[model samples]
Target: MKIGELVKQYGVSVDTIRFYEKQQLLSPSARSDAGYRLYSNADSQRLGFILRAKSVGFSLQQIRELLLIEDNKAAWQCADVKDKVQLKMQDIRQQIAELEQFYQALAKLDQACCGGALSATECSILTALEQGKPAQPETHQEDASC
Candidate 1:
């Protein structure tokens, strides 16, 4: 298929497909007489996998490792894949904890604000920011929804 067909089929921009080619993630299987790139069904499948991996926050390097494993499955172990997923999960959990801390701090600062007819210099949130106040500790009483 032509590059235009691929872009329309995948709902991605031409530049995105070109970038994948430049990154060595995807390659044209052949070129037409007019010098247009030609792709195969297998290439389309690989592009789909690349898009899915990116959607889940996989870096291009990580996606490359996955593609390598896909190309040579007999030489790779499932344990290696599991290890990478574990590391990603750990990073996500740490990020969530940090975000929760930030949320608490922002909430405290917002509550402290009087919202009166005061200038920015007199704002409590601004004063707290100027003083470099630390984030508040999380209260860990479990909620049913959580």
Candidate 2:
């Protein structure tokens, strides 16, 4: 089989397959005399693993470590993999917390800007953003409520 055929079967583009090979997420197949890659059933199966892992939001570096861990599965058990997963979950949780903080800050700014047709120079949202948000903002909820 060829790379193109395997990619089509997995609903991925040919460039994506090549990129994965370059990224070390997929290994290159043996080449013929003319230097064309000769993909085998094993390559297809490996590609399937790469695609599924990517779908789960694993980073390329994480995927590389996972592939290394998987290839040495004879020496490593499920507990080893679980430990790695737990660490990645910790990193993801931190990111979610930071994003939520950002969202809440923006929501507060939106609340302050609900004031309709205020003087542009005195606009609370613009002023807070330009000067960096203060501990308190001008109250606009008194004027606009929905």
Candidate 3:
């Protein structure tokens, strides 16, 4: 099939497929007499894999590494693939933890303010920010009203 066919079938832009080709993530199986790129079923499957990996947050580099392992599956152990997934999971967990901390800090700052129609100069939230007061949850009192 031609590149246009892939675009229609995959619901991705032509540029996206071209970029993947440029990145060595996807390639045409052959070129037509008129110089159009021709892809095989295997190429379509590879594109599907690339899209699925991206949907799950895999970087292009990570997808490339995964494709390398997949291409040489006989030479690799299942543990190798599992290890990569585990590392990604750990990274996501760390990001979640950091986000949770930020949420707690913001919640503290939010609770410190009454969300009233007070002037900006009298706003507790703005005051905390201007004073460089840290929004550490432990240091903030939930009962404190603006």
Candidate 4:
């Protein structure tokens, strides 16, 4: 198959495929007698895995590691893939904890705006922001729903 058809099949673009090739993520394929690059079904599968790995927030380095395991079938035949995935899951959990903290802080600030002067300087929004702390607030999820 040609590069263009591979893009259609994988829902990516020619530039993306070319970039992957340049990154050494995709191996160079055979060229036709006319010198056009010809891809095989394996190329399509590799591109698909790259796309899926990216969708789940795997970095290029991580994807490369996965590809190495995939190619060898031994890197993961034991417990290496499981360990790597466990580390990624731990990182994701830490990020979620930080995000929840941010969400709570923002939700807390919304309470100050409920009853305060309407002017910008006197505005609870501006005052809280300038002070970098809430002046006695209650956190609620509904406050941020809007």
Best by lDDT: 3
Would you list the rank order by lDDT, best first? 3, 1, 2, 4
How many residue pairs in model 1 have overlapping backbones? Answer: 0
Query: Residue-wise lDDT of candidate 1 within 31-59, one digit each (tens)?
Result: 99999999999999999999998898889
Q: Number of the top candidate by TM-score? A: 1
Residue 124 C-alpha lDDT in model 1: 57
Q: How close is candidate 4 to the true structure, as a TM-score?
A: 0.77
Worst lDDT run of 10 residues, candidate 3, spans: 135-144
TM-scores of all predicted structures:
0.84, 0.81, 0.81, 0.77
Candidate 4 per-residue lDDT, tens place, 21-138, comes to 9888996479989988898888889999999988987888889988999888954665788887887889899999999998887777776565432345455566777888674552
Worst 10 residues of 1 by lDDT: 137-146
Of 1 and 3, which scores higher on TM-score?
A: 1
Q: How much is 138 displaced in model 2, in angstroms?
A: 5.7
Which regions in candidate 2 have their CA more than 4 angstroms from the true location?
A: 115-123, 135-146
Model 2's number of clashes is 0
